[model samples]
Target: MALQHGVTHLVLSAFGCGAYRNPPQHVAQLFKQVLMQEYDGKFSQVIFAIYNDANAMRRGDGGNVEPFEKEFGIKASVFKEQ
Candidate 1:
């Protein structure tokens, strides 16, 4: 549908990985598989927008981004306390 409408950029998120309790690693892998095998070269860019609050991290909650960072081998955001 997006391609048919000439949309080039895409934005996605860690769906079902928060209050729904779906495993973020598994979700990330599924997204990777589809994006790589099915949507490759079909869009100008694809952005995975994952965000977690500082308070959430302080409470030991990974929120939505930690598992994705781990699955994708991305270092967690480093921000010193103000």
Candidate 2:
């Protein structure tokens, strides 16, 4: 849907959601998978603003930001500023 419309950027603004409320970590992966499948190769760039949600960011111990680049094959950058 979004991809079909040529959405270059996708934000998982799952704000005020259940999974975002609690998780064992995999929950976040599911979300990412869904997004990727929906917009795979459709967008030139995809950014995931998981905020401090370790699970959403796939952080095993703390948080791993590298997976975004390795798995998705897309350049992942974490931005924090005004």
The model with the greatest lDDT is 1
True lDDT of residue 66, candidate 1 = 72
TM-score of each: 0.70, 0.45
**lDDT by residue for model 1 over 1-82, one digit each (tens)?**
9999999999888886655666677898888788888988999987677655444345365766777777667765544446
Q: Candidate 2, residues 13-81: lDDT per residue as tens digits?
A: 334223344442444466568766764677675555645453544534434444434545656566865
**What clash count goes with each model?**
0, 0
Candidate 2 C-alpha error for residue 33, in Å: 2.4
Query: In model 1, what are the clashing residue pairs, if there are any?
Result: none
Query: lDDT scores for all predictions?
Result: 0.72, 0.52
The C-alpha local distance difference test score for the whole of candidate 1 amounts to 0.72
